[model samples]
Target: MMRKTLTYFLTLFLVIACSTVPITERKRVNIVDDAEILPASFAQYDTFLKENKLSTNKEKTQEIREIGQRISKSVDRFMRANGMIEEANQYKWEFNLVEDEQMNAWCLPGGKVVFYTGILPVCANEDGIAAVMGHEIAHAFAKHGQERMTSSYGQQLGGVAVALGTSGQDYETQVLWNSIYGISSQVGMLAYSRTHEKEADKLGMVFMIMAGYDPEESIDLWKRMKADSKGGAPPEFLSTHPSHDTRIADLQRYLPVARMNAREYGIDE
Candidate 1:
């Protein structure tokens, strides 16, 4: 009876929570509320800015901000056109450049973005920056973080369901079931993260192109990323991100589609 009830509730929850991602139209189950997560995200972003040193190079910092503004405005236009104005308005978009030596950049929910100085060289130029910027913004735009939190909660609930379902089983059988669940859940999450990464890549290219940036630069950017890694990246099956080689190939294949979609929006460039 408990198992049946759990199954019924889980199905109901999934049905209620399902949503389609913008651009990609992929269906996802996200139980986390923007109202619940955005305030915390804003607070954390504030704390991070207060703790980090802003870049001293005025020219580069201004460049990053300019590119961010263009890309973000394009994204805003897209959301509003698609009748996602409320979601678009919720974004308090801000971009920053930090004085750090890590080739990293990220966007927190609600459109807070940061770029480390070390990545500038990898970015190589304005086009490169747009490639990275669009990708990071896509993460926020898609609400990947919130989706991940929802998935984590689902995993915990699944664990509880497993415990309840196995209460009648012998100790050894329960242990085996849990062991299988643990391994499978971890791998499942890694795969989920990779999917998010790829989706971001595709969405980013479209956003960049819509903003009149070259979508093909994204391919070159990934090629540089591949060369920079020097073959040290983990195997794709075990990593949270697709391998650089995989990304470069994927970008190549998707460029034509991205350009076509951009043209539909009247972006001839």
Candidate 2:
């Protein structure tokens, strides 16, 4: 049994050890799905919506869908022009409005999008809606989910490797895998999650601009977010996002470039 388990572990290790990001050059944001994570993501989103009461703000909720559709569709066009249409169509593309009084929004692995009722006050208008939607859509387009999954697989494989290396050992490997595998495979090692958050901020601004929201608004949004941070949030180092300072700076840096792209591809409103 040990031999069999060891063989299995070795095979898993081989797969993960060999897995790497082939596109060394940072490519334009796009998702490539292999495990059909999108469908599961869509299903999970549906379940959440069914269980939660959606907002009765008929006009506002309709506006969310309108803005989400516009941004999502525009993002698709942008991706296609950039040579990644395949990645954009991976989602079924549904937007929902939840009745919660929290300024929150997210897009799932697929195109499942949700806007919380409370956020409307902050989002303030269609452009603000577009800003938030652009950020969420950017997270999906960048394949953040797959990146996280690949990271996880690496750690599991690493733990199994350590176990196999240990001559006649089980407890140590199991404990180590549980404790460190997740940490070890992180892309940035010391501050991997921050890297992802920053990437999302950059790419999100690109999409917001492409979808007709002024990229400059993103800077203000981050400022608002920074103020919100003081109210309460997970510490900067521990969360998947970096500090608002980093996000604000990145958004500012990307504004000019995003505006140029928008000028080339999008219609002025």
Candidate 3:
């Protein structure tokens, strides 16, 4: 009975979970839709703002807003030109500078963005900020977060299958199978995260160039990011994010293609 249940869910997953990413056309396994996720995301964003302090640095705050607006406009143009107008319209487009020292930034679904002060020195200037924001925005544009959730559910379902399949086994054997499932699922999740990060880098660079930022600046931004990490990051296989060197190299390789994409929007590098 458990085997039959597993087969049914697996079949349904195969049937309904395939989606193509907008810009890159990369196929992803994601069953969740925007309508299902955005309401919760917006609420979460509002709650985050209420709970955290907004940055008081007027100059830096203005810079973040300006850069975000430019990239948001460019992203709109790209989506419209590519027949994603409905998707573009769904974005509310808010940018905020939060008072935090972590070198981090993220764009929630529906285009809510928050940047930390600690990342500012690394950004160095408006173009550098664009580089960072562009990458972060691309994560939203690509719906990587929703894909990640769907993947997590898929992994959890695998765990259920293991539990059910081993119901008749000795305790030690079930423990062994569960352990194997846990490790394999974690590794798969890490791989999915790394792929999303790399794709975001490529799409972000293109978006930044389309918004009139220098594509070459993205490599510099990643170099700063690497230097900022100080070689203290976890090894690539176990980490959700790629190593700084890997990201820098990927950005360098994608530069020409990003420039070509920018030209399609009438922005030449």
Best by lDDT: 1
Which sections of candidate 2 miss by over 4 Å? 1-35, 166-190, 261-269
Ranked by TM-score, top first: 1, 3, 2
TM-scores of the models, in the order given: 0.98, 0.77, 0.94
Least accurate stretch of 10 residues (summed lDDT) in model 3?
260-269
- Which residues of candidate 3, in runs, are more than 4 Å off? 265-269
Q: lDDT per residue, candidate 2, 151-246, as tens digits?
A: 555556566666665646678766776556556555344365576566666666766776667777778777777786584766666666777787
For residue 6, what is the lDDT in candidate 3? 87
Clashing pairs in 2: none
Tens digit per residue, CA lDDT, model 1, 133-214: 9999999999999999999999999998989988999999999999999999999999999999999999999999988898
Each prediction's total of clashing residue pairs, residues at least 3 apart in sequence or on different chains, is 0, 0, 0
What is the C-alpha lDDT profile of model 3 across 34-132, one tens digit per residue? 899998999999999999999999988998999999998988887888799999988888999999999899999889999999899999988899999
